[model samples]
Structure formats: structure tokens, C-alpha cells
Target: MPKITYTQPDGVQSVVDVNEGDSVMRGAVLNGVPGIVAQCGGGASCGTCHVYVDKDNTKPLPEMHPVEDELLHCTSSPRQDNSRLSCQLPVSAELDGLVVHVPETQI
Candidate 1:
């Protein structure tokens, strides 16, 4: 399992352990973390699970797929170089301590 830190828009944070092979959005949903909506249930079709991965750690995450890239452009929050859809991030031991910042809103 890998522990991920989720920082909500209001500045509250939750550090949760995610099972390997599970999506980061799924981990947040299962743990009741107050940021990710995961409207499409881990599917890349929805942009509701948008997150801003800490810039320093972004390089370690897998590259964004074309579908995910396309969906990110639709996020309620502005997308940045560090922006990512949590649903597209799979957990792994190498990602332990990854940090993600949730936007103020997800439309």
C-alpha cells in the first residue's frame, strides 16, 4: 500500500493508504476524503476527479494518456502542468507519500 496526502480546497488534509493497483480517486471515495467527486467512478470520461499533484512529485507519476489529457481540459478548475485526474492515477509503492491538492470546485 502507498500513503497519499490529499489537501482539500479549505486547507484540510487527509493522509490515506491506497491499495496497490487502485486508482487514487477510488481511494479517496472509499476513505471518504472530502475532495474528489469521482463522478464517473474511476473512468476517465469525467473530469470531476481533478487534482493538482504537487509539482515536485509529478514527474514520478505515469504520463497522461491522450484520453485523460483530453478530459483534463474540461475541468472546472484551470489545468496546470501539475494538474491530473485522480481517477487516472494508479497507486504503487513508488508513489508513497504522493500529495495532491483538490480544487475549490469540480463542475
Candidate 2:
């Protein structure tokens, strides 16, 4: 399992131990974390699972595909340099201690 930290815009945090192959959205949704909406489940078709990867975290994430890039533009929150769809981020040993910030809104 990988321990991932999800931080809310209000500074609240939820630390969850996600199964190795599950997506970040899966971890948050299963644990009742308040910030991730995950409207499309893990399909990557919706931008509701938007999150900001911690700039200080050095772990490299997977390259974003064209679809995800396009969908990011549709997020209710402003897209950022570290913006990523939680559904696109899989859990792994290398991702332990990963911290992601939830934007103020997801629609």
C-alpha cells in the first residue's frame, strides 16, 4: 500500500493507505475524503478529480495523455503547473508519502 496525503483547500488533510494499483481518486473516494468529486469514477473523462501535486515531492508521475490534457482545461478550478487528474495517478511504492492539494472547487 502507498500512503497518500490529500489536503483540502482549508488546510485539512486526510492520510490514506491506498492499494498498490488503485488510482488516487479511488483512495480518496473510498476513504470519504471530502475534496475529490470523482464524477466519472476513474475514467479520466471528467475534470472533477482535479488535484495539485505537491511541488516539493520529487517523485515523478506518469506523463499526461492527450485526453487528460484536454479535460484539464475543463476543470472548474484554474489549471496549474502541478495540476493532475487524480484518476490518472496510480498508487505505487514510489508514491508513498505523496501529497496532493485539492482545489477549492470541482464541477
Best by TM-score: 2
TM-scores of all predicted structures? 0.95, 0.98
Q: Could you give me the TM-score of model 2 versus the true structure?
A: 0.98
Candidate maximizing lDDT:
2
- Candidate 1 lDDT over residue span 1-107, tens digit each: 79999999788899999999998899999999986889889879989999999877743788899999999899989999888999989999988999999998888
19-90 in candidate 2: lDDT tens per residue? 999999999999999979999899999899999999898986999999999999999999999999999999
Clashing pairs in 1: none
Q: Candidate 1, overall lDDT?
A: 0.90
* Alpha-carbon deviation at 16 in model 2, angstroms: 0.5
Q: Candidate 2: lDDT over CA atoms?
A: 0.94
- Candidate 1 has its poorest 10 consecutive residues by lDDT at 54-63
